[model samples]
Target chain A: MYVILVYDIGEKRVGKMLKHCRKYLNWIQNSVFEGEITEVKLKEMVGEAKRIMREDEDSLIIFKSRDERWLDKQVIGQERMSTDHFL
Target chain B: MYVILVYDIGEKRVGKMLKHCRKYLNWIQNSVFEGEITEVKLKEMVGEAKRIMREDEDSLIIFKSRDERWLDKQVIGQERMSTDHFL
Candidate 1:
C-alpha cells in the first residue's frame, strides 16, 4: 500500500521517531513521511512508532491508499524535500 | 472529492494558513487536514494558499482522492483534534 504518515511527537522523542520512519519511508517534509510498503513493513513501522511515541502526548496518523495512482497530488510554492525517487 | 492537505509555511505565516484551511477541511493533526471538499472550494483554497505562501520558502501539498472510501486513515497515540463532524 502507499501511505502518507504524519506525526506530532514530544520534542524529546521526535528525533527518534524521525530516524525510525526514515528507514522505511521517504521524508517529504517536517514530521511527514510517505511511500509504498508491504503490509508486513507497514506493521513493523507502526510498531516502531508506537515504541517511540508517548501515548499521552504524541500522535501519529497514517493515510493509506491501495495505490498511489488513486491519489492526485498538487504542490504549490516551494518543494522542501522531493519524493521523486519513488517515481 | 476528498482531500488531505498539508502545509509547511514560515512560522510567521503558518497561523494564517491554518486558519484558512480550517474553513474548508477538518483539522486532523498539526499541519494536517482532511475532509471532503468541492472542486471549486479546493481551487479557491489553493489560490488563497499561494497568496499566503512565500515562493522561496513555503509549501502546500494536497492529496486528492475521488472519494473518502478510497482512502483509509489510521491514528495512533493522542488525536489532538476530532474530525467526526464530517462523518
Candidate 2:
C-alpha cells in the first residue's frame, strides 16, 4: 500500500519521529513522509510512532491508499527525490 | 469530508499552487494542507488545481477521508493552529 504519514509534535520528539519514520519510509517533506510499505512494516511504523508519541501534545496522520496506481501524487514545489543522496 | 492535499512542482509554478491552495484550504505545513471541505468546494478546488497545473511538470495529490470523525490526525511537531492568526 502507498502510505502518507504527516505529523505535528514538539521539538525534540519530532527528531525522534523523523528518525523512526526514516527506518520505514522516505521523508518527502517537512513533517511528511510517504512511500510504499508492506502491511507488516506499516504496523511496525504505527507501533513505533505509538511508542514514541506524546499523545496529549503530538499528532500523527497516516493516509493509506490501498492501491497506488490510482493515487495521484502531485507536487508544486521541488521534488525531494532530486536532491543528492544524503548517504 | 476531510481532505489532505500535497504537491510538488517547479519553482515559478510552485508559488501559484500555494496561492491557489490557500484560497481553499489552510496551509498546514510546507506543501501540505488538510481540513474539511464540502464536495462542491472540493470540486472547485480540484478544478482550480487542474486549471493551474502544468500537467507535464507538476503533480498534485488529494487524499479524501469519508468521515472526519474517524480521521486520525497525529503530529510530532509544532501545531500550526497555535501559531497565532496570520492575518
Candidate 3:
C-alpha cells in the first residue's frame, strides 16, 4: 500500500520535507511520491513531515490503499467510472 | 471506514468547506470531523471542497480507517505504545 499525502505548505518548508524524505527513503520520486510503501515506513516519513510542517499548520491526506484498484477508485469515484466510454 | 481529511485551506475556503460539510452531513462536529462516512458522501464533500480551495494549493491527508484501534495506532506509533505506562 501507498501513502497519499496532500498538504499545502510554504515553498521553503516543502523543501525541508523533501530533504527529510530523501534522507530516510533514499532517492525516490513519483509525481506525488507514489509507489509501494509500508504503513510503518509511511508513518515514519509522516512523523518527520509533521515536524517540518507543524509550524505552518499544513493540512494532510495520508492513507494506505487496500490495492491499486481501491486507490484508483478513490481518485475517481464509482459514478465517474460507470459512465466512462472506454469501459 | 471513516475518512480522515487533512488539508490546509485558506481561512475563507475552510469556512466554505465547513459550510458544505454541515449542509451535507446535517450537523456534525468532532475535532477534525472524526466518525463514520461513506466513500460516496466523502467524495462529494471533497469534490466541493476542492472547488473552494483550488485557489490555494493545499495538501490533504484523507484516509479510511480499518478500525478504531488502527486509527489510535497511527496517532501513536507501535514503538511509542510499547513503552506506555498506561498499558
Q: Alpha carbon lDDT of residue A75, candidate 2?
A: 53
- Candidate 2 differs from the real structure by a C-alpha RMSD in angstroms, to one decimal, of 5.5
Q: Report the error of model 2 at residue A83, Å.
A: 6.6
Best by lDDT: 1
Please give the fraction of native interface contacts (Cα pairs under 8 Å between A and B) kept by each candidate: 0.94, 0.21, 0.00
List ranges where model 2 is wrong by over 4 Å. A82-87, B1-3, B7-23, B26-31, B35-87
Candidate 1 chain A: 10-residue stretch with minimal lDDT: A78-87
- Give the poorly placed runs of model 1, Cα more than 4 Å off: A82-87, B82-87
Candidate 1: residue B30 Cα off by (Å): 1.0
Residue-wise C-alpha lDDT for candidate 2, range A8-60, written one tens digit per residue:
76787877888888888887665667788998998888888888888776777
User: Per-residue alpha-carbon lDDT of model 3 for B1-87, expressed as tens digits?
Assistant: 554443445455666665565544422111133456776877777777667665324433344554533433122211111122221
Q: List per-prediction Cα lDDT, in the order shown.
A: 0.86, 0.71, 0.45
- iRMSD (1 decimal) for each model: 0.8, 5.5, 8.8
lDDT of 1 by residue, A1-87 (tens): 999999989889988888899899888877778899999999999997898889788999999999999999898876646444331
In order, the first chain's TM-score in every candidate is 0.89, 0.87, 0.57
> Could you give the interface RMSD of candidate 1 in angstroms?
0.8
The worst-scoring run of ten residues by lDDT in candidate 3 chain A lies at A76-85
Scanning candidate 1 chain B in windows of ten residues, the lowest lDDT window is B78-87
